[model samples]
Each structure stands twice: as structure tokens, then as C-alpha cells.
Target: MNIYSDLPDSHTLGLEMYQLISDLYPICRSITGDGVRKTLHVLQQFIPLEIHEVPTGTQVFDWTIPKEWNVRDAYVKNNQGIKVIDFQKSNLHLLNYSIPLHETMPLSKLKEHLFTIPEYPDWIPYRTSYYEENWAFA
Candidate 1:
């Protein structure tokens, strides 16, 4: 189900990364807890999920659900001290799960883990490591 924007008409993803998501699960999968609930809610229009909600800090085995990182905006400046990338323009432009850091380093060091797809520069190549901790410009 669409949340921030209108749901696309088709159920198949396109060659592009953005289209892939909608193309695949127009009515399935859990992109978020709320997204999951919304999907299941739609299914309840035919079936049900008997869903459950766990409070913050609740632990299950070795993993505990994290407090959602609803970042409205973020950005980084170059060594020249220029704000090159602004997260406010796009949430997917960031390295998700990155530790809170605001220091500057040289271009050589900074570009190590940076992700930039020249073939699809217009598309923010969304990357994440829910279980890892390394951030870079992409």
C-alpha cells in the first residue's frame, strides 16, 4: 500500500531500482511496521493477520527492535565546507544505520565507502546494513 505517495498502477517492477519495489509487492511484503500493517490491513479486506505489537525496548532473543529512525533530514559538507548532499531532498540518499557523525576527512578517505552509480545517478542508490555499522557517501 502507498503511504507518502499514490500507489502505482502495476504490480511488476521495472528495470530501475525504484520501479522494482512497486513492481514486486504492490500488495505484499513489509517495508515498515506500518507498511506491514497496511498491507495486512488490505489483505484483511479478504483475510486477516492476528497482528501483535511490541513496545519499545522489548527484547526477542539476541535482537531487540530498534527505535525507528525517522530522519526528516540530514546532509554532509565537503572538505571545502560545502553542503554537497542534502538528505532533506531525499531520504534514500543516506547510508542508513550510520552512526551519528559530523566530522570531515579528505576526499580519498571519504570516497572509500561512497556509493555513486554513474549509470543511475538520478536514482538514489538506497543501501543499508541493519546489522552493520559503516557509513559513506553514495
Candidate 2:
């Protein structure tokens, strides 16, 4: 096989890859959500794809497929009613597969559910609860 002839130029492929990343960066993707479907559809344009459907409880050997999880929106607002951690701006701010929650609580109580990395003030932390029924801001 002629590897050189089969592949696009490195520079061209790099640009295409970068463009694909740019197009997908805004999607609030998780283990299962419309964002994932959108991403797959985008890639479907470039190659052939065969999708498979498996029920949430289906067992494969010793493992069971968990529920398809998706989060619509999540945020934490200050007492003044201003959002301090808005998931809409950056989906990473919310914990992945977090259970739905909407409530008002004191900072002491809310801090229990707020995860962070003090070392990196500018970067949002990534957290998830695929097995636990819980909620938190990352």
C-alpha cells in the first residue's frame, strides 16, 4: 500500500482536524446526549458509520449498560441572584451525569456539592457521577 498516496498532506489533515475540533467545542457532550449524536453525525459526513442500539439494562458478559444520561442545564447563583458558575458558558463547570437539582441553599451547604481545583484558578475541573445519584458543580 502507498501510505503517502492514501493520506492527505499532513498540513491539510491538521487543518481539517482543527476545524472539526472547533465545530465540536461548543457541544455539551457527556457519556450520552444529543451532543454525542451531533458529533457522530458530523463525522458521518466523512466516513461510513453503522450505529448500534442497546437497552440500558442489557448485559454483555459481566457488565450492564447503564442509563443514557443527559443534563439540560445547571448553574449556581449567588445570593444576589447572579450566576457564579454557569454550565451554559462552560459545560465542564457542571459534574457529568449529575442528577437534576434546583434549589436555594447557604454557601456552607452548597460548598458540599461544589468541586474545584484551587491550583488552577482559570481551568474548570472535570467531575462525574455515572453510578451515584448525585449532583455537583465542577
Candidate 3:
């Protein structure tokens, strides 16, 4: 589309766009929730916006909108009750749509839900079970 064709392709513009990406990177976002609202609010500062709130269960063609899902905060603590992994540090550490888990489980059992990128050992992976009821760590 020739919509944004008026925008320049200059290095300064690229840097400004990068800044916006950096600003949005840390937000814990999902397909639905306040994170999405917070994101749109941020965008409004740079552009005109007309926000629309679609209720849960609203039918859009053959699909039904699911309930809004938001994670105020999530973390996994060790046996000693010390936080080992947190969503605040990296939102990708928590799988999307993970139900609240606040119980102690054996590490071996927990490993079944924990995921990793074997090829890229240094990187944390992102997983989702949006259409199903499941939970995991990344």
C-alpha cells in the first residue's frame, strides 16, 4: 500500500522506529488483555487512535472471542521459596496463557513443562497454548 509511502527511509527515521520497538519490547503482552491496551495507548502518543473494546464471546464470523487474559505478574520460586525465574525480567520466560500456578512440584516433574532452545542455549523460547488449557515455562 502507498499509505506510509510519505514517510522517509532515512537513518534518523530508522533510529526513531527502533526506539519505539525498544519501548514496547518489555511489555508483557498477549492476544488479549491490558498489555494490549497499554500498547495502544503508547501508540496514541505518536498517532491518532480510536480505541474499540470488543467484549468476550463476541462473534466475529466463525470465531468467538475468548475471555481477556492478563498476567499482572508471574514467577517461579525454588524449594527454598526464592524466585528463580520471573516474567518481569523477560516476558518470554512465561508461556502465553499460562494459568496461575502457586504450588510446589518436584524439579523433575516441572521439567516436563519447562522448555528451552537446545540449539540456541543462550536464548529463551516463547510458547503458547492460547486455544487450549496448558501451562509451561521457557
Winner by TM-score: 2
lDDT digits (tens) for residues 70-93 of candidate 3: 987788889888888888889998
lDDT value, residue 33 of candidate 1 = 43
Which lDDT tens digits does candidate 1 get at residues 26-92?
3222233454566566556545568777764678898776544334445778767677887655556
Model 3 gets an lDDT of 0.87
Q: All candidates: CA RMSD in angstroms? A: 9.2, 2.2, 3.8
lDDT of 2 by residue, 1-138 (tens): 776897889999999999998988978887666777887889898889976667778888988776787767889999889999998999898888888887999999999998878998888888988778889997
Q: Which order, best to worst by TM-score?
A: 2, 3, 1
Segments of candidate 2 deviating more than 4 angstroms: 1-9
Candidate 3: where is the Cα deviation over 4 Å? 1-9
Model number with the top lDDT: 3
Q: What is the lDDT of residue 111 in candidate 3?
A: 91
lDDT of the structure predicted as candidate 2: 0.84
Give the CA lDDT, 0 to 100, for residue 70 in model 2.
72
- TM-score, prediction 2: 0.87
